[model samples]
Target chain A: MSDRIRIVVLLFPAMLIIVVLFFGGLVVGLMRSFNYMPVIGLTEPNLQAYWSVFTDQEFFLSFLLTFHIAFTSTVISSVLAIGAALLLRRRFVGRALVNFLFQLNLTVPHLVGAIGILYLFSQSGSFARLAAEWGMIAGPADFPELIFDPYAIGIIIQYVWKEIPFIGLIVLANMQSIGEDYESVARSLGATRWQAFRYVLLPLLLPGVLSASVMVFAFTFGAYEIPALLGANFPAALPVLAYRKYTDVDLAARPEAMAMAIVIALLSAVMIVIYLRYSRRRIRD
Target chain B: MTHVSIQSLTKTYPGSSEPSLDNLSLEIASGELAALLGPSGCGKTTTMKMIAGLLEPTSGDVTFDGRSVLRDKPEHRGVVMVFQNYLLFPYMSVAENVGFGLKMRKVNKVEIDNRVNDMLALVKLPGLGKRKPSELSGGQQQRVALARALIVQPKVLLLDEPLSNLDAHLRFEMRDLIRSLQQEMGITTLFVTHDQEEAVVLADKVALILDGRMKQYDSPDVFYKRPVDKATARFFGGQNFLNGNATNGQFKTSFGVLDLPIDCRRGTGTLTFRPENICVTGKTTETNTINAQLVEKIYLGTQTRLKLAVGTEFIHAVVNPAEVENLEQGQRVNIAIPPESLWVLTS
Candidate 1:
């Protein structure tokens, strides 16, 4: 056989799984999103599901809430991650233990983390009792509402907590690969320590930081479990709301739910494209 | 121009018993280019960092023209260093990289642009300012680094093996460029290098370092002709060492008695001479000539290396190929060593 054909044959197994499973599901979802599900006797494809989704006031609210969660969580976590990486890159006592503990949660499932946040941060949870005993609050019921609050503070906290180390690990590796030479050069060129980091090291680290952050943004944008577990009932996170529609007794809501899912995927895809373009320009420059 | 002085600089890294840089001292005259010449791990880089104020010395001071700079930070010390890899900021343009120091000093935009262009012209990299550092070749990037450091008009310029990352051809070109620029600008430069030839060719004075200590600091010719010890002489390519005891002006070795210079130290010592100083076919001198059988002949392109035996000890000499063309391995030849070429090392 030719080399090209042999390589394709070898890659066929992995290609089969991705093309059949991932793109296949995406095509099916796109089909239903246009109201073309033949199982429901709707052979005609149209934009009615999208029209209904865009017409709903609650859809826009859920979108803003989801955007807020993703953007705020990503920004906060990215800043904290950069800070942590800078500190961790230096040599110190107990650094190995600290780095190990910082990355330990990456193995834990997101659902488990949401549950932990719920157990600790809910109004009647352990923190509430502790606060009541300490006279910070009169009773458990008087504790501030974090979970199931209108602002989705609990959800944002969970994401920021989990994603800090996720992005921190990437930024740390990037910092190490960039090394201290550039900063040393900057210092010798009459730059103060802060200026060295700000001008030279920060610009060098931006491409890696942006790529890692885009991944976090996309994951948090489309994820459902964390929002569903600790979200308000009135205007839920977009994914949670879409899932609710997917499981509703009304069969017509299924197409709108698929439309929302496709919308979420499109937004995340847009972010990834921006990231790729930026990194490409960086490499070329 | 600034007179650079390093007084008893020492550094012992944490958890290490041996000092990385021992009590080292140097006095570089204003506008002089001095090289810290040593093998790798010989504390050359350590001493460079101490002078640049990038490293904290365990106990000592670095001064510029009689002012101690030990309390100053690296930026405040008015010293800049060009590193081995020419670490140009990848995100910046050539002009920006060169003007970075002026920008840090808050120089105005128009002035920075003018000076950046002038510096670029000085480095022979004019009109390449719009390009990024990554787009330039290795030699060009190195020129950009030199321009960047020189644009700051630093008191002392420290180069830590600056040409080490380049190819052989580029290394030679950069060596010429560095020497010309140092002479042109009259900057007090302390260059660190492991190559003896490079140190000799570029430095006004070369300081030979060995095992974390300064062995000898003198002019380039002195390092080759009058090294302080066996190691320094060996480092400078001295191949013939005769162990003997010198009393008054006469040296007694296993081979025979030879005349020593007037300043030769008395008692037990080793006498060293360069290989090229041994004349294979020449008029015999009365006291320093020896008759030995040629044991081996290795044909080098420009010179032939002949191993000779005087008694049980072997001596290697490099002579013109034409002089040794008729000589055979077992044939005996009389070789003369100039008395002035011999340097006695007491330690």
Candidate 2:
């Protein structure tokens, strides 16, 4: 009994955080989403907010936009990550510096990464000035609009830039542990370099690549800050739309905002379930 | 004619001054299965890797059929190595593993399948081709690796301790299997082993290497009967050594003097012989006889190992069990070291 008491006491802080910030907040959000705001005299339990959000063409477009942004960024990041990991697996001069450059952004907040993307790709950013100096364009106005565009190109660049090294680290670790013996054996047996890589290293590297890709996809699917900062005003990402509606001045708009937040949470939950299933198929001995 | 010539081969790993293989040179004849015998850290595997192009040498060239292959890519170099661990691709089925090289060569699917089946049958794993490498037994996995390498018809086949992982019965079985397979295929093979018996029995010629240098290269009979040096003599089971001074044809030792049957320089030398070669008898009258007191006798059916004490030296002799059956422990016996049986090792 005392041992159980000790464990419970040790876990009390973490459990309190989970209950108050996670589940307790989730319950409040759910109640508000169902039109149960007693303070505003709307106490009847109903699914009107869900129906409104589902029928709203803007909401539907934002949801699709969110999916498109996450999916595109994830696919691009996975390809770049696999290529970088394969290249870095070999010993080369300045590899340490390259690895350090990748890790430098890893721990920085996503907001910071989004700001970096905006600075590099904004109309009046350094790239435009350099292009102007080179006489490639007339002025900063002639620079292409990459950030805050309807295509969400800036949001994608931010997410992909941050996630590539994250996924590459996981894959490089797996490939290094697998060693180069199998490739050497293949070469000894008259396999050309590309043939050896395709028939041997690719099969061995697939499981690691796929598992890391799942993590990358799940993370980008629910990411809020980068999309909120870089996405356009109209077809905002799901998280950005929910956050914008939550901060609106109208008191009655909170319920719809709660509904969108609930939808985002549910979609993230589904992604986590799928990710767990894929993770269980991890490489076996 | 030499099929594989490793001329002045040396490999010094980066940041190391001492070479792993120091200017080593050896020639392997066409269709000859040669065993590269050495103790651990003797650069046998290094030499083999240099030939396979898996590892580049610091200085030297390896040629197949008088053509230099040092600059060739490993895929172009028609050399294959069956590594120590039998590295069968874990994700591939046995048949797929065997067919990989053929697939790389752009062989037709039908031809690849046919050759894979035939190769599986050749390695005695015919019907088990669909099983993954992890599912096969150690011996079966080894065969799969062998078949995978052999299906490509490499110009030089390198076998690196292929039977080391097997149990005793399987070791002997695979030993015979490998020998017969090599003979049937007529592949010029380089077999690396630390096992002296495996080196002697498995190869048409044995090259005994020590400290990354070749000590002796000769037939197995020469290795056993007339080893070139002390290392080869000891490695090839030279159990008895009588250090003495040689004057003319006679070697004078503390125990007794024995006549050297072969021509020897009149100086200090060592007489080397196997225990079984020295005959222990009750009567002795002539050359190469040692009169010693029988100290101990171990009766191992068909042969009795006798530990004889002469003056201050002990000589081990293996005689017929029947001859030593009735001998007492302190009986005087004469051990005849026949001149032909003794190898006068000068160094």
Give me the candidate number with maximum DockQ.
1
Candidate 2 collision pairs:
none
For model 1, name the residue pairs that clash.
none
Clashes of each: 0, 0
List the lowest-lDDT window of 10 residues for candidate 1 chain A.
Answer: A276-285
Worst 10 residues of 2 chain A by lDDT: A276-285
lDDT of 2 by residue, A1-285 (tens): 699999999999999999999999999999999999999998997999898889989899998888788778887997898789888887788889988887677898888888888888999898988998899999987998989888899989988888899988988898899888899899998888887877888778877877787777777777888887888998888888888889999978889999998988788678656655654454321
Candidate 1 local Cα displacement, residue A110, angstroms: 1.3
Two-chain DockQ for model 1: 0.80
Instruction: Encode model 2's per-residue lDDT on B1-347: one tens digit a residue.
Output: 23998898999987677888888888889989999899989899998889999999999899888999999999998888999899888888888899988988999999999999999999888798889998998999889999999999888899998888999888998999898988888889999999988888899999888887888888899987887767788897777787888887788888777777665556777778888888766667755777889999888887888899989888888888887788889999877887877777874
lDDT of 1 by residue, B1-82 (tens): 9999899989999779999888999999999999999999989887877777787899998989899998898899889999
